[model samples]
Target: MRIATTILVMLATTLPAAAAGQAADHRVLPFTPSGQGDPQAVVCRAPQKLENAEGYGPEICLRNGIWILLTQDAKDLAADGRSVFKRPLVEEPHGNGPAEAVTCRKPPTITASRTWRGPVVCLENRVWASLYERGLTVTGDGRLVSTRMSGPATDPTGMPVIQTTPPPRDAPVIGGYYSPL
Candidate 1:
């Protein structure tokens, strides 16, 4: 009876530790995208740790339909040890008409520049714009000085520039014949 009681106690303590260890080694399941599926219908893996760099996280589904995983480098602890960070691809619609209307519920990501600093605003159409601060007084030589506008700036072009979304790294290539493993 004592032996059985000791076994139960050991299991009670060890099981929780084992379960925690398993949780720490979290990995995302594989995904196969359908040809004619909606872009919003896609899902990716969840991040394991909270200490992720900007624009890159584990199991994050990028706008290009790829799942990105940033794993720690077991080797090379000093130089190039961290994973690469990539911004999501965005495609803007083209028109001679007025600039596409955009609204932000939260502050957008700020991208710093030597000439001009601005915010990268993601629009409702999933398009992103790198807009310059409006009403900034510039020198005769074109250096930015001060701004009369407040909050985030607006696109100087009156039309926001859009970028094209790229495909996932592991996505199948067209016209290339290869055998599936």
Candidate 2:
């Protein structure tokens, strides 16, 4: 009886550890979405508008280093190549330069944003109205990033989007892939 009890206790602890170890082995599988990875596939707003640009006429919010390629269509984020950008991008100074290229990778994913950093220039096409106004923004357009907060602030949505980590270990990270945001 004493030996059986000890075995049961050991099984409870070692069993979980063994299972977790097996899970780690299969964790490296690349996460693939259901389509030809396209940035325009994501159709939604960042919720927090960091900067605004007036292209053509209407106002466009540059969120998470991405500019609102189409004010009417949030999913369609285009680089301001044809002088489409109207705001003072943090990347270009003086606001007058050729439309730079943005090395677009995978598809546009969605994640639970951690914090807001105002406005910033993460892409080249999102360069200043031209190529003269390049810099970073201090606002967050409701993008996703994993960060550790120190103080007690609040999400504009009155919800907890940013947190310690993502949903689960196997959850597909949103808003791009590695490196958080």
Candidate 3:
């Protein structure tokens, strides 16, 4: 009983600070996109009117709930709902070449397995990356394999960007593949 009372007292003191922090975040990032359909990816671009950054990613476009999410990376559509939180994700594609990839200098989700967040390409600095993982080899008779994963992607700006999502060591890559095993 005593411990419970002490805990309540602590909450009474910190509750105000927590509320203030959330209010500040809301004020700083007021615009959020509306979307619904299996949270995939999101981007927070320099907002201008209602239109946000197009091309190159899940840029913020419209308003949704408390938090904003990106639904369609191409059309810049806003998500309809908010995840428990946003996920910082990386896009590496292997649909183009055996080792072609583009490395997004941002934080990404740490999925249980490999995640293909974007198309395969070679960036200016030549950072090999892919949205797909495994290799061109598949269980089927010489066919590219792909899978649709469903999960909530956390926000990076609100959260701290941690260790690089991509491999620490640069190496050759290939794409158009998935693994159920």
Candidate 4:
């Protein structure tokens, strides 16, 4: 009986350590809704592939180092390079309410390689914007600054969109590259 109890205690201690190690490697990206508009922008981890998925739309990685799923209509607007910060706020056509605007600062420097530091913006019920291929640099004040890309923006359809199954709940936001704004 003493041996069994010792083993149980050992298991309990090791289990937590093991879990913490795994957690350390995994990133938690929480869904942060920005606007007051209806059908709030849904941000979550995207599946590895978007092929033939019903209701699911295009995805983009935010400056916060998290992936988010956008509504179809919102996807369309983002594809056009429109940002809530650049455009005037307006009411949703469906009369849900005034659209909420999201703004992100441009990265301070541009790089030739893929990076998580880029501009990201979204409006409630309207659009989701991102600067693909751009790198991000966090300022001393914790603001996300954008960097320039070595090349011109690629075709939106050609951007690297990884596929992964959506988690049941929003993951906790993690990673060193967080949005300063």
Please report the candidate that would top lDDT against the real structure: 4
Total residue pair clashes for candidate 1: 1
lDDT of 1: 0.30
Write down the TM-score of every candidate: 0.16, 0.14, 0.18, 0.16
lDDT per residue for candidate 1 within 18-101, as digits (tens), equals: 444344343322321111224323332333343534442333332111221111110001111123332342222221222332
Worst-scoring 10-residue span by lDDT in model 3: 66-75
| Tens digits of lDDT, candidate 2, 61-138 | 222222223221112322321122223233223323334423222222234665323333233333333332332321
> Cα deviation in Å at residue 166, candidate 4?
67
lDDT, candidate 4, residue 109?
38
TM-score of 2: 0.14
Please give, for residues 1-181, the per-residue lDDT of candidate 4 as tens digits. Answer: 4454444334333433444434434332222234233332222222223235544332322222111222211222222112211233232122133333343333333455743443333334332223222344445333556654332333354443332444336675332222335
Cand. 1 TM to true fold: 0.16
Name the weakest run of 10 consecutive residues (lDDT summed) in model 4: 64-73
Q: Which stretches of candidate 3 lie over 4 Å from their true place?
A: 1-43, 48-73, 77-133, 136-181
What does candidate 3's lDDT look like per residue over 126-169, in tens digits? 22223343323221222345454323333433343233334336
Native-structure RMSD, model 3: 20.9
User: Quick one: ranking by lDDT, best first?
Assistant: 4, 2, 3, 1
Q: What TM-score would candidate 3 get against the native?
A: 0.18
For candidate 4, the TM-score is 0.16
